[model samples]
Target: MGQHTILLAEDDPDHQALILRAIEETGIPCRIDVVENGSELIDYLFAPPQSDDREGGGTPELILLDLGMPEMDGFQVLQVLRRVRDDGRSVLAPVVILTASDNADHAREAYRLGANSYVPKPTGFAELTEAVARIVKYWLVTNHGPPADRSDPQYPGVQSI
Candidate 1:
């Protein structure tokens, strides 16, 4: 596989720009597909528009989800993704919660909803850079959940339900 593709689900344009810069700094050369909200993120993940694809690809390697977005929100998106990818047929990408929300409830709910990693979106650019780097390194490089970690119980991935 090439550099792990990161699907960054964020609504704000400025945040998107910052995220792009931070991710690039890691020399990962990620192909991040930014979505404004949860529904769009799901659409992109499941049945993306033809224009979104230069080559045929099924799913991404990682999902950097924003918990707070218009339409559906990250938690709901994760539920749906888990529902759809319940089978071990396809690769269920590791879903990491990346958000500005500092609510402890949100963090608790995120883990309960099957989030593999919960990363608070840092305020400082340097910290943001570090967060992005670590997120990518841990999920894509270090962590190796079962192929069906998100899907199959026996597959030992970051499973919630």
Candidate 2:
């Protein structure tokens, strides 16, 4: 199985349901852990919930983020995560912003703030399913996301980004 497990941080129950269903349809075997808010996403990623509650091996490979959450939104979580990485506390992970907002400015800000990709949430179920499947095939199968320091120099289209 691919080591790229997905961590989805979303608040909307209906949207979360649909996203989980789409992810399952993608046929990827990676675990998909769902969190209701961005704060929980941070806890699950960096700090285990509780030693007894979380016996998972390690952190997730990718984050499917929602920008507008209740208390701590995706951007705030991204900022904290970046800070942690900058401090050499942990390796950075790819964060893909998946939200209903179509604001171009928002997308630009997300990219500026360390988001690897900003995909507008598809409205229809079929389209969303295809998008999720394509995302899995690309990120989990084709693409490689790693920390900036250890990348091979010969790898084209790769950068410390």
Candidate 3:
């Protein structure tokens, strides 16, 4: 009902523009943070909260990850995200692999590494728009996300339905 946040990890500038436009076409009120590579994404997600930084609100509701990135790649990012912290909790937000690669092996590996969904990047603007709309509506509107309090003893990380 309110504005949600999405973190997009995409290295290609062209792809970033396209994805941003597609998400805008959805007409959903959301804050999207774009990181050029997996390492930047990791920094954005793990950096200590700054009280004055409104853009860096907090953990995103969903993460749109591109498998091909400089420095750490999407799979490595997922590994770090899914790793259990000392407190026995992992990142609770769902990660969706939105990549240009249509290889089945990539999809399989992404799932194995804790990706919630693997979507091959649409070639056309219209298709990309539709796909982004559906993804945003489903994850930000229809889906019931994990609890926010990671420190809670009963809190379980994102789970598959």
Candidate topping lDDT: 3
CA lDDT for candidate 1:
0.76
RMSD of candidate 3 to true structure, Å:
4.5
lDDT of candidate 3 vs native? 0.79
Off by over 4 Å in 1: 48-55, 85-91, 145-161
Local error of candidate 1 at residue 137 (angstroms): 1.3
The residue pairs found clashing in candidate 1 are 149-157
With a 3 Å backbone cut-off (N, CA, C), the pairs that clash in candidate 2 are none
Runs of candidate 2 with Cα error greater than 4 angstroms are 1-4, 55-57, 147-161
Return the lDDT, model 3, position 108.
97
How many residue pairs clash in model 1? 1
Q: After superposition, how far is residue 139 of candidate 3 from its true place, in Å?
A: 0.8
What residue runs in model 3 are displaced by over 4 Å at the alpha carbon?
49-56, 85-87, 150-161
Candidate 2, residues 21-113, lDDT tens digits: the string is 888877777777788888888777655345555444355667889999998998898788777767666665578898999899999889888
Q: What is the C-alpha RMSD of each candidate to the true structure, in Å?
A: 5.6, 6.3, 4.5
TM-score of each: 0.81, 0.84, 0.85
